[model samples]
Target chain A: MRFALDLIESFRMAIDAIRANKARGALTTLGIIIGIVAVVLTLTAANGLRDTFRQSFSAVGSDVIYVSQMPWIMMDDFFNYRNRPPIDLKQARELESKLQGRAIVNPYLGERRDAKYRSEIMEGVQIIGTTEKQLHMSSAVPATGRFLQPFDVTYKKQVCVIGSEIREALFGSANPLNQMVKLGRTEFRVIGVMEEQGGSFFGDGPNFDRQITIPISSFVKAYGGRHGRLNVDLAVKAPSSESMEMVEYMVIGEMRNIRKLRPTEDDDFAINKLDTLIDTFNNMMGVVLLVGLLVTSISLFVGGVGVMNIMFVSVTERTREIGLRKAVGARRSSILFQFLFESAFICLLGGLIGILLSAALTAVINATLMPASVSVLILVIAVVVSLTVGVVAGFVPAYRGARLDPIEALRYE
Target chain B: MAVIPEIKETTLSLNAIDKTYDMGVEQVHALRGVSLDICRNEYIAIMGASGSGKSTLMNIIGCLDSPSAGAYYLEGENVAAMSENQLSEIRNRQIGFVFQTFNLIARASIFHNVELPMIYGGIPRGERRRYAEEAITRVGLNDRIKHKPNELSGGQRQRVAIARALVFNPSIILADEPTGNLDSRTGGEIMGILDELHAAGQTIILVTHEEEIAQHASRVIRLKDGEVESDLRVDDTDACIAPSESLHLVGGATS
Candidate 1:
């Protein structure tokens, strides 16, 4: 009870002192504000950036491996093997044949196209060509209609699946299935429509919501590209979690054989795991956060120095108070605690305000600005750092104030 | 250690105490073989001139400074060899002080200043406020409790200082030139308050250069140069000058 009372008194005194000298306290705490603001803003930005990446790689499934033109996490080996050529479509097919019952292999072809239905049009939508296996590798799912089947591509038919965004644009109130849509200059029947994919996180690359998909064989015929020069991605599912390494090895050997590479020659292919991508992005964010914090800490250092200067001035101004306290039976330790608590309180107050402001700003961003997120973990860290800054800055002045002699202090004019 | 020799279970004691200051190569003696004793409820004053070392002697007696050589006892305990921390403890728990300038925190309320010592003593929060208010009320500044030191009159500020001193229930109240900053009229009101406290058996040590201020005490000790020139007991001494009636405030008799 006594301790609590003393602390309350000290806080009251501190607040009164600060209020009495409004300009000085405000100016001194400005440095702390900047420090805390910097910490909070930087943390929020990093959090937003992390959220952006997490969403940007939305098509990368958590438990799935995406084998394409590049590795998800770039290693020294990948850079060192930069001379490697793009993995071909035949290599994808051969890997499927070799892995037979052990894996689920799906091949895809992406063709850039535009479409219109009943005077409704969507520009720059991709006409993706892929097997059913490709659907499970991404976070995408069909809305109402079924995905393309083997029968749709068996005779190189011109049937297509339109994404929900295209369906919305082309057919407002009607179901898109069985509806005819113009795919570039070619006409195709829409057999399926996808669900709305929120925030097109693949950003500007290939917005699935604005997409339409045709069979791979039909795309090859319609686009009329080099048949052997396939613009395709192969997604191979391992038999189980434990089979991931075996699946990778099996695909590599099959690709080398299909590409007819000599025993001494290096083959080309990029295998990407969702976990590796997540880890790499997180590591980069850690480095960015570290650098940001180091720079922002400069303001905190200045704030600490400000606290020191202001506390020194306070000591001088309240010299008689210190003396009076000493004369009243206040121990040196009590004096020390009181002064320390005052300065610490000042910094903590500033820091908490800064954090709240930053949180408010982040909340606004979360509500309207970015699809990415800032975590509570980062907020917690920033608050802790600000508090430590205050405690450290308070020590010197508290010590000086505590050490004053009652006689001299009281006698001070 | 205090200069006044204490009684059995009483507060304050001093025995043949000596104090000297080293002025570089020059030795300036402040007190030489001086002895005094004070029991609870005694109101005494020390009178001196400009260079009479009264202030230095008061500092030693208040435990704000240690004597160069002396055996002093406070409440029957030998304090001559007490540590600085111990001296501080005694000063806070056993002695209250009032200085010449009122010495109230300028921007603080009368109540705040009164509570300052209690805060240092680490009193419980609710009780600190309660005692501080009571102390303010006791000094006849209850209505002015929230007023800042700057807003207060000289006598009122002194009252607040006295209330602060009295708050902790110290063994003795030490006043060092307590009336020095006030006008002659305001000074008497403060002196009256001290007298009342003394009447209530609160031991007091008043240090002053004014003979009138010295004469208000039950005993008067005069210092000359660096030694005690005279020591005697006197009663109704402020009455020696009846012209002080205009300065006395509240219920005390006209001086």
Candidate 2:
């Protein structure tokens, strides 16, 4: 109880000391405010970027691995990747046959084509061709009508599932299911409309909501392979997120066997997980956050030095006050705590303001730029940093003040 | 550690206290072999000119400074050899100091200034408030509890200082030229308050150069060149007037 009272007294004195010289206190805390703001903004921005990537990648599906012509993060050697053999439906079939009962493979191919219904035309619509199994590998779920059936793929039916955007653009308020939409001179009956998914990511590419899907056989019949081979992306789905690595290894070996690659040769195809994009983005942001924190901490250090200088001046100016307090029975430790509390209180004030300002900035950034979040952990770290800076900066000056000789201080004019 | 000397019926005793200052190549002897004993409820005054070592002696007695060579005891505690923290505790619990400049904290209210020693003594808030108000009332500044030092006149400020000194109910009330900053009329009012406190059996040790201020005490010790020139007890002196009557005279003069 006594300790609590002493701390309260110290805090009151700290507030009084700061109020005595408001301008000097404000100027000294400016550096700390700027530093904390920089730290908070950096953390929030990085969190936003990570959240955006996670959402986009989860939209692609976490349990699925993509077998593509190149890595999702892009290879360092562009020429080597460009010259590699393309992924095809043949390779997808071979992998599925070899891994039978172990996994599911959904071969996909897409083209940007204009979709139309009556006189209305929606240009740059991503039209994908895949088997009925594509539904299992992706997060897409139809909100209207029914998804494609195996019979549609077997009979090579001219039926398709329209995305939310394509449905809105071509059909307006009219029900899109059972309606006919034209794609590149071919008519397709719309079987379903997929649910709305927000925010296109992956370099701002068109999202799944802006695409339509049809069976691979029908797509082959409508648009025959112009390069004599079908260029496809085989989305290989594991039983669960935990089994993804094993599925990836199985598929890589199957693909290499299908291609008849030599033992010493690097695999000609890429097995890309949705998490690689998140990991790469995180690594890049780590560097950015480190640099930002370093630069801002220098300013915080400068702020601490300013606090020390002010404390020195305060001690000199309040010499008689110190003597009077000593004469009244204040111990050396009490005097030390008084000045230390003053500095810490100033830093804490700056940190709180900085946190509030950064929260505002994060909101603005989320509205205008990208998604951002300020976690409780970041707030805790910011507070701790400010307090540490206060103690480190205020130590020497408070010590000198504590060590002042009462007699000499009292005698000082 | 040096053992404390047993001295009965004594509130303060300084045995052969010596204080020296090293001034570059020369050593200045501020106090050389000064010894004195003060008993409880004794109102004593120390008279000295400048460089007579009275201030140094006062500092030693108040536990503000340790003498270079001495065995000083306050109520049988070996104060001369005590640590700084111990000395601080002694000052907090045993001595109430009234300075020449009326050193009340300028930014604090008269009540807060008086409450300072209690705060250092770790008194609880409720009790501290009660005791502080009582001290303020005793010093006749009950109406000025909320006023800061600068808002009051010099003599009122000194009263605040006195209230601060008495708030902890210390063993000795040490006044070092308490009336030095006031006019003769206001100074006499302060001296009259001291006279009332002394009459109530408070041990009062006052340091002053003025003859009139020294005349208020029953026992007067004169110091010359760091040594005691004379120690006289003027118990029957006519100047030691009754406090209430003197206060009445002061009121009439002021009005």
Candidate 3:
């Protein structure tokens, strides 16, 4: 009880002292606030970035696997495997038929091709040449007119569904329905204008809306000049998350069986799933967050240094008071507790203010842009780390204050 | 000298004490064979010049420092062997100090300064408030309890210090040159307070270099070169002695 009273008394005195020097105290705590703000804002943004990445990658759905000649990060390995022959349109059709009714496999072909919409020409449009079923598998619906029908793909119709941007460029308020649009060296009728696709694994940087889609058979017949055989992509949509892995394995098995590869030989083609893109994003975010934490910890250390400096000054100025307290019934623990409480109050107050400041910034950013999901775990960590820094920085000065000789202090003039 | 009545309760006592400090192999003696007895109601003054170890003696008597050799007793309990905790408890419960420079916390109110001891005494806030108020009232500063030490005059600040020392009701009130910094008039007023406290049966030790301050006590111990030169009872049992030059013959100013 005596010890408790002593601690309370010391706290009261410390608070009074701090209040007396409001500007000084605030200046001392500014470092802590900056440190905490940096840590909190960066971590929260990183969390948001990670989430956005997941949502964008999963926009294509989980069961769907991408078919590409080269692996994403391991694209260097693609050069070594350049000797392998590309899978053509016929092989995709054969695989789709082989899958039967169990899973829907759509033959997809995409190329960074140019489009000439009269006076304005857009380069590097992702000309996704695919069957009507491929569009249905990814749950995509065109904004206007009709998507390519099975009859159109079989008859090799040159009808193209123009993206919203492409529609604006070619017709500019004129109805694009049945209008003939030029795709490189070919004339294709614009059957539909696609709605906004919103987001993708890669950002809509070059504008995905400024693209055109034609039938895979039409693309092979028209754009297949030097390449002769079209490198087709197969997208398989499983019924649910549980069946996704099994379906992927079965598709690979069917492909292996089709290629007639022996058990000892590796599968010729690559099956990239949504998890791969998600994993890449996760890895990127981990590095970003790690770097952010390193920067945050440096600032926290700077804040801790500021705290120690201020605490040392406080101990010196309050020597007589410390002596008086020591002379009284105050134990060493109480004095230490008092100083620790003072330091923690400064740091925690700074942390709370920084949280408010960061949250306000997040609110503004989220209002103008995408919402940043702040992690409760990160918030807890920031606060805990701040207070711990305060305590650690406070310990030596507190010990110094508590251990001052009462008589000598009283005698100090 | 006739023996004074012993208050064997031993409010303060010391035996064969030595305090030595080393400054680069030269051992400086701050206290030497200092032995003294203070009863529960004795008011005594210790007179010493500069470097006479008066401050060291006060520190020992106030339980601020332990002697290099010998024992100290506060209220019949051996204190020299006690830890800092025990010394602090004694300083809180048995002794109250009034410093020459006042040493009042610069920013605290007069009441808060007085409440300091009671705070250290581990008195609860509610009780501390009441006791502090009473202590301030005792020093006739009940109206000025809210004033900071800087706001008060030298006399008032000393009174605040006195009130601070008095608040805890420690049997022994230790004053180390308590009126050294005050004007003669204000110093007299402070001496009056000490005389009053002594008369009211409080044990007091007055540390000073001025003979006039020592004259107010019933007994005086004079120190020179870190050793007591004289330990004597006041002449004719007078608590207030005139200046030694004989004011009547010299026609000194009197108020």
CA lDDT, every prediction?
Answer: 0.77, 0.84, 0.78
lDDT of model 3 at position B156: 97
Q: Is the docking of candidate 1 incorrect, acceptable, medium or high quality?
A: acceptable
Per-residue lDDT tens digits for candidate 2, residues B30-132, read 8998877677777889999999999998999999999999899898888999999889889999999999998877767888889988888888999999999
Candidate 2 has which clashing residue pairs, if any?
A: none
Each prediction's TM-score versus the true structure: 0.81, 0.86, 0.85
Candidate 1 global CA lDDT score: 0.77
- Which regions of candidate 1 fall more than 4 Å away from where they truly are? A72-94, A97-103, A110-128, A164-190, A199-206, A210-212, A219-232, A238-268, A352-356, A363-368, A372-386, B1-10, B15-36, B124-151, B233-255
Q: Between the candidate structures 1 and 3, which one is better when assessed by lDDT?
A: 3
Candidate 1 per-residue lDDT, tens place, B169-194, comes to: 88889999999999999999999999
Off by over 4 Å in 2: A18-37, A82-84, A111-125, A167-189, A204-206, A220-224, A252-266, A298-310, A353-367, A371-375, A378-393, B1-8, B23-27, B222-255
Candidate 3 per-residue C-alpha lDDT over A303-395 given as tens digits, one digit per residue, 9 for 90 to 100: 989998999988887777777666555566767787888888788878888887888888887788676855788689779977998899888
Clash-forming residue pairs, model 3: A143-A195, A329-B120
Q: Write the per-residue lDDT of candidate 1 for residues A1-413, one digit (tens) a residue.
A: 54565567667777777788778877777788788878888878887787777675676565556667666456767665555666556767787788799777788877667788878877767888777676767767777878888887777878988877788788988977898888888889988888776554445655667778888778878875645566457887875768788887777777678778889975566677767767877888899999998999888998889988888888888888888777776667766777777677678777877777777877787788774344677668766776687678877888888899888898788
Give residue B18's error in model 1 in angstroms: 5.2
Each prediction's DockQ against the real complex: 0.46, 0.43, 0.38
Error of 2 at A209 (Å): 2.6
Using lDDT as the measure, the top candidate is 2
DockQ, candidate 3, comes to 0.38
Ten contiguous residues with the weakest lDDT in model 1 chain A: A197-206
